[model samples]
Target: MKKYIKIARPDHWIKNFFIMPGVAIAFLLTEHSLKDINIFKLICAFFATCMIASANYVINEWLDAPFDKFHPTKKNRPVVTENMKFSVVIAEYIALIAVGVILSLLVDKLFLITSLVLLFMGFLYNVKPFRTKDIPYFDVLSESVNNMLRLMMGWFVVTDSSLPPSSILIGYWMAGAFLMATKRFAEYRMIGNPEVAGLYRRSFKLYTEKTLLASALFYSLISTFCLGVFLIKYRIEYLLCMPLVFLLFSYYVAMSFDPDSAVQRPEKLFKEKKLMLLVFVIIIAFMILTSVDLNFLHRLTSNSLVWVRLD
Candidate 1:
């Protein structure tokens, strides 16, 4: 029983916080006040997301047990260490899916559809014949798409009438990609042996530390560019947060260089007090920017074609 629960990885559900950004963005874009929100529906949306994510984790653990043995830390996971019954694992996965589906029904139609897509993505990532996780860069992009899907789930919970801005969605996806690439880089570094890492993850055979870092750089650059467009188009006030954003990314990159990086275990990242503090500060800043309108920022960024008198 304990093993079954452990395989669900409730602790890792912190990743579902990604959904909050969608909620926030929805509120911001829709100009909704607190009174307008359906709190019960929001709670249902959150739990539905958590349940589906757990289902994904269950399947991920079961399927990756073979490869996880090659991982130093992951070798200790319940699936790899315990003699678990296949039937029980399948039951757990189905149960979680059922719970998620039921909860999603309480939310809007778009949320329900997004949750289903999130579940399907887990199959595409972990199941054979379509396991994009085996493909080098595709692995990163495919996994990161969950970030966008989760965001959409949050957005739809608030309003199903319209989609999120493409610029912000693209930025969020690229940001997730950057984070995923960094995680891979940290894991590759910790493994310290290319052959061993390759055995653990098929994508590693084609990934070098330099290449991974380069990919991370590319992802960050693209994220920044898209996010900049979003801010310029929607809320120029967020431009004030850009410096902190750069600092956050640079700080994360530095953390990946550590011998034991928390990037590999984001669920345990509270151990890095300074990093968590920075994240908190960034969140506060974002919240403030979301509410306040800086009209002067628009004035500053506005294009004013000055007329020069020509002889």
Candidate 2:
């Protein structure tokens, strides 16, 4: 059970929290409501995303084991350490992905499409020839689009009645890219030099601390601009929340300078007490801003959990 769990990399499933913002934002936009039934469906969708993502992680580690053994830290993974058999890993991937597909089908068509896109992109990301992970800027771009797909899945799970604002989706893309670049930056810094980093990730051969830091900063700035646009259109009251986003980005960037920043594995970010508190504050702010004015959004937000009594 433990070996299987290791292959699942359940700890990293935190990355799939990307799915929540979409559902929450979608509910905030036109619906401003979250049905108990919708929450159940959204849980299923979240599970589907996690299963597929974990399958992808297993595949990536399997293929990367050859080089990962050389990494200072990745050497601990089951695949890299050869603690589990290759055939067992393959079986686990199939089972998890199969269940993921079934769950996606339980949602709407758009959800199915998003699941397929994530699966297909996952294949391209770690597989030979089409492996985007080795392509520098394109690597992060491909991964960022997967974040968009996760958002789409969350949106579809609730009200497929309409699409999220373009601004939110664009912001999601930049934020994902920002995270990915920072991860690379952390790995590079942790390894201490390009020559050593390149041994684990081919694209590192083309990167430098300056470029990675610059990219992280640049993408995060774009993320801020896009989110600012979203706030303007959605609920300006949410603008107050923007500073939290900026701070989160900056905090992670600062952490990346450490030899072993939690940024390397996103789940670790929450392990930091202050960062987690800030995230909690952001969630609370969203709840407050959901129906800032009694406009149409307020009407929908009326029955939302924020205002609804459990009784």
Q: lDDT tens digits, residues 72-153, model 1? A: 9999999999999999999999999999999999998889999999999999999999999999999999999999999999
- Error (Å) of candidate 2 at residue 60 is 0.6
Off by over 4 Å in 1: 291-295, 304-311
Clashing pairs in 1: none
1-311 per-residue lDDT for model 2 (tens digits): 68677868888888888888787777667645655346667788988999999999888888898878768988888776547777888898899889999988887778877888898898999999999999988998898888888887888877777888888888888889999999988888888867878988999999998999998889998889999998866675677788888888888788788778788888778788887888898889777876565455445556564566775
TM-score per candidate, chains pooled: 0.95, 0.89
| Residue 17 local lDDT, model 2 | 81
What value of lDDT does candidate 2 attain over all alpha carbons? Answer: 0.83
Query: Best candidate, TM-score-wise?
Result: 1
